[model samples]
Target: MIFPIRSKAKVLALALLVISAATWLYLSVGETEYGRSLGPVAPRFSPTASLLGDLESRLQEAEEENRKLRLQLGEVRNEEQGTGLGSEGENSSHCDHRSLTEKCELIHVAIVCAGHNSSRDVVTLVKSILFHRRNPLHLHLITDSVALRILGNLFNTWMVPSLQISFYNASKLKTDVAWIPNKHYSGIFGLLKLTLTKVLPSDLSKVIVLDTDITFATDIAELWAIFKKFTGQHVLGLVENQSDWYLGNLWKNHKPWPALGRGFNTGVILLLLDKLRMIGWEEMWRLTAERELMNMLSTSLADQDIFNAVIKSSPSLVYQLPCYWNVQLSDHTRSEQCYSELADLKVIHWNSPHKLRVKNKHVELFRTLYLTFLEYDGSLLRRELIGCPTDGEQQETRQEALSKLDEEDPCYDFRRESLASHRVHLSFLPHQTPPADPYDVTLVAQLSMDRLQMLELICRHWEGPMSLALYLSDAEAQQFLRYAQASEVLQSRTNVGYHVVYKEGQLYPVNLLRNVALKNAQTPYVFLSDIDFLPMYGLYESLKKSIAQLDSYRSPKALIVPAFETLRYRLSFPKSKAELLSMLDMGALYTFRYHVWEKGHAPTNYAKWRTAVTPYSVEWAPDFEPYVVVKRDCPEYDQRFLGFGWNKVSHIMELDAQVSRLVFLFNGSL
Candidate 1:
């Protein structure tokens, strides 16, 4: 080693030369593809082998844990079986298992009517409970006069004699005490005072309290059975798990015992009277009601808040049932995930004033079903029940009246005979209006000129002065001679009148057609007719009656809208014809005179007038079809509105002050 060290200078020079060559080679070759070809291959690990080893260890550990847990569970089960404490077996008694001598009886329920009254809803609740429950039950009505009078009478007259019931006036119990600010509190203070002051029997074991609006669709016996089976360490209550900071703060400040769950809805409660007495709950209630105590605890919580605070910290006595037992009636549509729970709802608590404003079919069905629960008689029953009369007496009486009136009335036979004859012209007069002078109600069949032959029978039977305005577009006429032939056929059918208006020169087709009609119409009122719309025999008579009822200004009192029945052969176009037909069929039949024009109304303004009045009026055709307007004063439709929704709002705003009243006649089936 010493001899080698003697040549350190020479060795250092050699090492430097070697390092420089290696660096030069690396720099020159590594930058090119040829350099990469000289590199060593990397080694790969066996991931599968590693993963298997990890899994095997986990499996052994899990098996060991499972064995220990099973052993512990077995020991606990043996102890429970020996003591006969837990009612886990199929043969376990539904009643008190601890004391074999005692048996559970029917639960006595009392409805506490506090702030508001829902007597009709309560009646349904009572009826539903009675119908479904097999256990012997008694309903104790505790309410003020507002709830008692309505519910008492309905129950007395209608409820079958099989159910046992009693009524107690809660108002007579001096229970007026403030439990919360800005809200009227009832029941808690009053009921507590009654129990403490010896007004109520202290010996009572248990009582179930329900709100007035709750509906019981299924038997509650199973829930009661579960409650009885459990050790009576705590009073049973329904927990509203969604309680917020307001409730938490109440508990914090009041320094009451903490409970596991949050807040409980006072709407439904089960009180263990014996346990409450033993715990001196009456004295606690009295102290809590005192002004000094309330002032101190008021910031912490209300009566419920205080109760929860004390109960939560002291002992675990409260239990929460399924949410379906008390379904909250709300506006937000429940998702499918929540439907299973909602479908099984036994009690619906309508929590909001706007609850009925919801429009879902499921909610509507729920409401209808709930209404059936309150059946007073057939009339009330019919509201929820199908094929039932709303009133029990009306069912029998209306049937008799309908039968007798059928024999006495001759109009029905006349209508039948007229329909069978297939007469082209007939008259329908309003029941209130007298016969007036008949004016020529011109039925101008405005078609695309190709549908002329289809109108031959309609034109031939025009007994009232009628006219035909054939509006043919340049394209339609230029493209096909069949259209021209159809127009010629229509003209030949009737000599009442005919005007062939070529739409080639007009800027807008509909406007040009209307202008032609306005210039040619000789009648005081022009009937706006679509090509597909056909008049039944009594159509003009109906128009005359509607026109006669108009005010002195000759402004239409109501437009006699035509009812259009669909024909099987006519094919509809999606973009143009179908839309136009829909507008003609479904657009509002009634138009306001004020909206047409301020100075005077014309036949052209009828289109705009109809749009404005249809939404507001009740007078509509059964088929949602446009009404036949036999204008008393030839109200011109605004020709500027050639296409739909064009200048419609501006035109409507202009005539806002002129329309007085609108009538809509809705056909019930549509």
Candidate 2:
């Protein structure tokens, strides 16, 4: 038997050698003749049946041996590198199953967006996730009521498959972390992460927490797979800070909070809820915070400082994630080492105050990724919903996670109730509806349901696109849509757009509504006015002609249309500027807001508008906010002023600062 095997081996070696020699001889020729293979210089000869069969058998044996040897080599390398084996005790089989689970399982993510202007960052972040996600997502958002309402309205229109969104009132958790002093610009909201274990449902075993300024470039399922790699003692996963801010070497008198070696950034965190609850994470962190605050005054980085302090004392509680997972793009560091080693970025963290505009060599790439999601048309995500697994899909697994929590927890009822109250509904609003036909100008205004009557009047006279941002509840918004549909003037026109914004616990956000309206206007020109104002007949065409005559549509100019108001709401609107002037002389009409706030529109100089032949330039004043026909890209309204006072003034001030000249047009009045 040994002699026969040896003979077969010798034949195989000789056969391989002959094949190698032929290939080498063919390659030695020039490129033009290489493919011709020397025209089979020697005549092809058939080998005996017995010899061919023996050779084929030997080749198969050799290939099988090679494959077995490679498997042995891989096992040896994995053992030497201390790579962990799966629960099944087989590395290869475990990896295959793990990958399959990652693709099909549900992923839970938590984000904190507690104040105004957070929508921009949250929108970009969520968009990036939905853009690259494969597994179903159960998003847990911690936010205030205002943020909750805005985000709910926005996400309600998105019909992403297997996507479930839930909101928790950050105000409910405010008291939990308010005692921890924080100087971060996000205020107490920055510390909201400290309450995640308390904010989320007790049944949820783990969740990926992220800051709003991060954008994902890879499938998040890959990141979730890291959780399976966590050791028994590890309760959190985080990447080390890229900059020297935590090293206390930034400047002469820099007083950074306490941190471990280079410190771990809190921008991206993987939480093991079961492990944390079993180890009494809340009590442990409270003790750590007390000790750290004794030496330091307050935290500049909020929860990041406290998280590092705890990790410094108990290092085994954390699993160090790779740097590429959270590529920090602050001015202090571009994460050059991570970028050089990585083939593709997993997540981009804009941790600096400059955000996407941060000064980094890779800023453009990061900014482009963010903007791609920022401008991404969300309607594209509204495909037919593919129902994800329900709570009963993994009943046993969920119960196991739930069993980890203390059964006698005192705050369980309160936490559950609080979360329930803030849980927002999905798919309540219609998809964003744009006008079917394009227009030269869009009439932009904001109003509540009480002002729904004015829409018909304004739409009838304007005879152009009307972009209205309505502040109403979900029910009220539906009712307003029904009303608009029933109206002949509004329903008959194809150039009326109704943008519904949810009204929350805060006061009327007039400027916020205005900004929403202005931003939604798709025309080259927009008429920024109040919903209560009635434009004169032929005002839309008149303004179009005036803009053409002055050629101001392309310039940073606001063509002021003189406004007149009468006490009687049912009075006929003026047909022309001449008729408006006659009414003004007879005291039947006065400039809009003239008696109450003259400086607001006095800059337009209504007296000169009475007889002006051509558009006259009006220098901007402090409170000047004339209803004007301006390019849609003019300065946006400041959202800080929610109520009536100083709402329009700040917008006008920004326009003036940007040198947007205001000019009075004599075409018509609003």
Question: Which candidate number has the best lDDT?
Answer: 2
- Model 1 over residues 483-590: C-alpha lDDT tens digits? 434465443533244344434222334533444444444465656555555455455555555454443444333343523333345434223223434644664322
The TM-score between candidate 2 and the true structure equals 0.55
Model 1 bad stretches (over 4 Å): 1-104, 114-116, 176-200, 243-261, 288-303, 313-315, 331-344, 356-365, 375-670
Instruction: Report how far residue 305 has shifted in candidate 1, in Å.
Output: 3.7
Q: Once all C-alphas are superposed, what RMSD does model 2 give against the true structure?
A: 19.4
The prediction achieving the highest TM-score against the true structure is 2
Q: Model 2: per-residue lDDT, tens digit, 1-670? A: 4433334444555565665555455345423342234465855445578865665675576566656655554555445334443221221212234334444588999999854357547877887888777778889999887578667766653445577889998888988889988888878999989888888999999999999988898778877887877876999999889888788957787978777889999999999998899899999989999988887878989999999999999999998777777889877663755655334578988886676667778778778877677656554553432454443323344346555656488844432222111112221222234444333778899888888888877877888777888877645644775686688776577666566665554467777678777887778888998898888878888777776666635556767777778887567667766777888888888888888989888888777777778777888878777777777888888665655688888887777677546655555677
> Against the true structure, what is each candidate's TM-score?
0.37, 0.55
In order, candidate lDDTs are: 0.45, 0.72
Residue pairs that clash (backbone atoms under 3 angstroms), model 2? none
Worst 10 residues of 1 by lDDT: 421-430
Question: Can you tell me which runs of candidate 2 are displaced by over 4 Å?
Answer: 1-68, 80-100, 341-343, 384-670
